[model samples]
Target: MTNEFSNSENLFPAYNQHEVVEKLETGFKKLNDKFINLLEENQRIKQHNKNLQEENQDILRINLELNEKNQEISRNNLESNKKYQEISRNNSNLIRINNDLKVKLQARDKQIEKLQNDLNLEKQKNKEIQRLEVISQNLEKNLKILEVDEIDINTINVFKENNEQTNCNINKNPTTALNYSKGLDDIRIVVGLDFGVTYSGFAYCHVIDENMHTNDNWPWGVTGQFRTNTVLRYDDEFNNVLYWGARALKNRKQNSEPVKLFNLYLGDLPDNLKPKLPIDYKKAITDYLREIGMFIKEKICHLDGFDYFEDVLLVLTIPAEYSEMDKVIMRQCVYNADLIKDRDSEKLQFTTESKATALNCTFMFVDCGKYTTNLTTRKLVRNDPLHIDKVTVQIRDFYGSRLINEEFIKFLRERLGTCTIDLLKENNYEGLQYMVKKFYRRITRSFTGDDKKFNYELDILYEAPILLRHVSEEIKEIMGEIIEIKYNDIKKMFDPIVDRIIRLIHIQLLNNKENCSTIFLTGDFCVSKYLQNRIKEEFSHQVNNISVPALPEVAVVRGAVIYGLSTILYGTEFDGLKLVISSRLLKFTYGIQYNWKSSDDLTHNGKNCKFKTLVKRDTEITPDQTFSFNFKPGSKQISESFAIYYTQKYNIWYCDEPGVKRLGILNIDLSDVQLDSRSINFGLTFGQYEIIASARNERNRQEHMATFCYPDDDF
Candidate 1:
């Protein structure tokens, strides 16, 4: 108030100042009240804002949860789609499997139809055979009646005796007649398989004209290949067959290796060479045979209008030296190839290599003996009539190609290191083998009559440039290096093989007791002039005559075809033909395992009670003969086992003689017989190529089995 209204109003100014002060205080209080109200309002707004923030946070949380649920739902839909796709694929697979099963069912139906047709044909053939038998009986009777008028009383008596003996023999072997009835009359073709170690050949013949046929041609290198290489190739790891035969040779020429000598290691491998083999040899043989089967079907057995399988008879030739076990393995190889799946069928036949070769030689003797001065002028031949009978034949293993091939292989390895040879084999095995073979053939063919210069060129050995000539020492290097070989060096290789052959021939002659004036040489080795000359030179003093037929290498295969026809025509209307081998000489002494019935039996009194000889070696035998024996057990036993033993040696001196080998086991169950009261009857027959044994109990029930124990066999 102007400093209190300037005192004026000194006293009055004091009251005015006090009133102004009160108004000032009142104005300050109002502003303070407004400030307090604003504070309260701000507090209330802050509270509201805090509540709104909490609510907003809750809403945000709920929204996040909803988003997460949506994502989970999408993931579940994806999983459902994947399940549906998997189910669809499985359905497709099931449909394919159903279609495959349907195809198999149709094939089975066709097979059943074929079997039924064959059964009907077999029935018809049986009836025809019965009718022919009756007609044959009538003709025989009429011939006897007509002979009585044409001959004297003594001849008539002889005819009666001969007829009675023939009747008795026919009654003894009923199965001989059964075989005639069982044979197929619709046979149009016969096949022969000569599955040899070094070579293989196949032949076929028509029964109508009886002319043999052969597959003289083959593929992949040369023409007129009657025999292809027995070779096979596998994968790098040796798991599966890649190729076989000539095709194998082609592949081997192009950086692939092959397996050879599989034939010699069919069932048992030689100890010296076994460790070198890395794969199963039997499987290799099976694969090789499978290819051969295909070859035969495609090349030789493809007749124009007939099913080759239905009208064909297959005959396989086996080495005479092969044991029963080896024969079984050969049969298995044939079966595994699906060539002759049923061994029990009459369509399949097995003949010995020696037997067939002998028959063929005899056929030549009958055909060509009249034309050769060597046969007609010899004293031994003059004493012996030109009849095919009464002459003994000797078979030996010296007449084989194995020794020569082995020596050639040895020569290759010595000139070339095994590592280098192995590498070359991996690179071009066939080229190397073909080169060696050409040299071998050249040497064998050209080196005759003591010639010193046997020339061979090594330029064809490989694709790389190289020169091979006479060298002083052996050296092995790459393909481009010079390879030196000499005539004397080559002669050294052939010398040992020649010596072995001569030694074997000498042994064979020493073992033979029969007067064999005529000697027959056959097999692929017959193609070797050196072998032939050596044989003729060495045996000139002992043998009076020698003969080598034309196409001597094909003799075994051709003879097999002849044998098939002979069996079919035997004892039939065609039996009168001269093309028949009526008898065979046993090469081994056969016997039965015998325990002496009485201790006092003088024949075996001081000897080991083991064997009784039934047929001696060198004795002539008919294929339809049976030998009977009595079995009397001392004790009461219901079952027993017996064995058959054979000896190539002189005799079975003891039960356990080193030379005596157990041939087979025969089992007999005598439960139905009076074991303690009666003796059992047993019989053995060699009517076919294999042995057949039969046992009869007291109840008259008979059991028969073809028993042959195949032992480990080696060449």
Candidate 2:
């Protein structure tokens, strides 16, 4: 306004200045209020962020806990599902068995009805006939009961004689046949059994006394004799056990027949031989072992110092040649005998005959016994001095003395003509067994490959009356008086056995790269002088020394005694182990089923072949080494788990080839686990004699019972 028009402008300018100052003060006050509000808001926001962060941490911890809980629930679910499937399978088997029995019962009922109709038609004619009919009806009812409790021999189709299959049926609620839980803590004595084909015995020792111990009075006549013949006899109908061991061979009855070479047939026999055996082979084994167990309980377990049944560790020695399935059957027999609880694997330990010999011998050993032969070597591993493991190397095991005995039996049968055959055909087998036992015990043990001959004179005094009535003049002339067997005839039997043993020795020498100088010979069959001489002569160049232990017959059982004692001493931590077998060679290829990486690799025999190998055949494994596999649930459903399937209808699906065996399914439950796409992990550790398996989820480890079911093995 140009200084407010001269003099007037001075007063206007002053007023304007005062007004501007007031406006500036107002603007400053408003700005200060806004700053104060922003500072308060900033402080409040910092406090809020701190509270949120704490809440987020709590939520994360809760999620972790929930995941852990979910994992545990999933494990439980898995276990429950496995149990359900097992129960279902068992129920199906029972149903099938029941149906078979019903069919048989219907057939019997029809037969009875026909008999009754005939009896009714002739009712007034004869009371004796009615009485006979009642007896027949009673017999029919008893036979029905027998069918329910007993296994039918004709139905058993034994797969492989070499690798016998065991019948494994899981019960809904399995209860221990014997009381094992009560006296377990009081165990002071351990026992070892050598269940052999030709002979059987046991050794025992106190937890304190480590030296070998044997029952001097082992069933038969003498005080020092520790072994008895492995034989069992059944009554007329083959439904009941009449006697066992030496008594069965010695005592001949009208209706009883001796079951010799039962151990060789522990697995099912060939199809052709199945019908010849009128009773279940597995049952026969169990029955025989039960009697043996009873003998042990009375003689050793019930001794003054040890009165309780469970206060003992019973170890068993099995043939090294036996397959895994065969071992399982033997274990089942032990369970059926009530010697130990069925599932108490820790209490019951099994050692191969060769392994036991290796444990006891200072050098390599050859165990030539009744049914099989085994070659073994022991080596020391000093890498871990504190827990030094004994590594046992088993070379070969195959059919041994029994094969030779069969050849001898065949020769005898040929020489004896129809004399023994006619008796067997007529169901009069007692005399034949008696004659064989007499000749075997007396002459067989004394045979040597020499010009000297043995005289086996048989007295047919009792059979003279029967022979006279049913004999042609030519046969009568040959069998008139005593039948004598000469030494040359016995030599024929020794030669084949000796030759076979020599071949085995040659193979043993070839396999042993170390040129082991010494060889130890032990077992009942090794007691034969002729066989021993032949082995020595054949291996003279390769082997520097071939020696048999003084107690060849009892060496295995005695070694078993040492094994048990060593387990007690060395198995503990505070007491250092003086002897131990740390590792062993793998006999077969071990692996698990798995999904294929691509569909192109899935086809086998026009079906899907899905599997991956974990352990290859002949691969060396250590106790510390672990094998693992993964199982991913494809579906979102919690109930779904890893399932095993077959590629072919009947062909076995194995990880490796040549001869593939069937595989069993693994039932792992994941029903309760929140699997937002997570995989289940499994691991395996090679134990002393078993492969230990474990399973785990994302959050925690899972517990499961591993059950392997094979179609060919079902009973």
In candidate 1, stretches whose alpha carbon ends up further than 4 angstroms from where it belongs are: 1-178, 235-240, 253-257, 265-285, 322-333, 363-422, 460-486, 571-715
Question: In model 2, which runs have C-alpha deviations exceeding 4 angstroms?
Answer: 1-186, 216-225, 234-240, 250-279, 321-332, 380-398, 424-428, 452-470, 480-484, 572-715
| Residue 27 local lDDT, model 1 | 100
Candidate 1, 109-213: lDDT as tens digits: 657745655554565445445445554675586586776546678767766775665555444443333333345566678888877665677888888888878
Best by lDDT: 2
TM-score of each: 0.51, 0.51
What count of clashes does model 2 give? 6
Could you tell me which 10 consecutive residues in candidate 2 have the lowest summed lDDT?
162-171
Compared with the true structure, model 1 gives a TM-score of: 0.51
C-alpha local distance difference test of each model:
0.59, 0.60
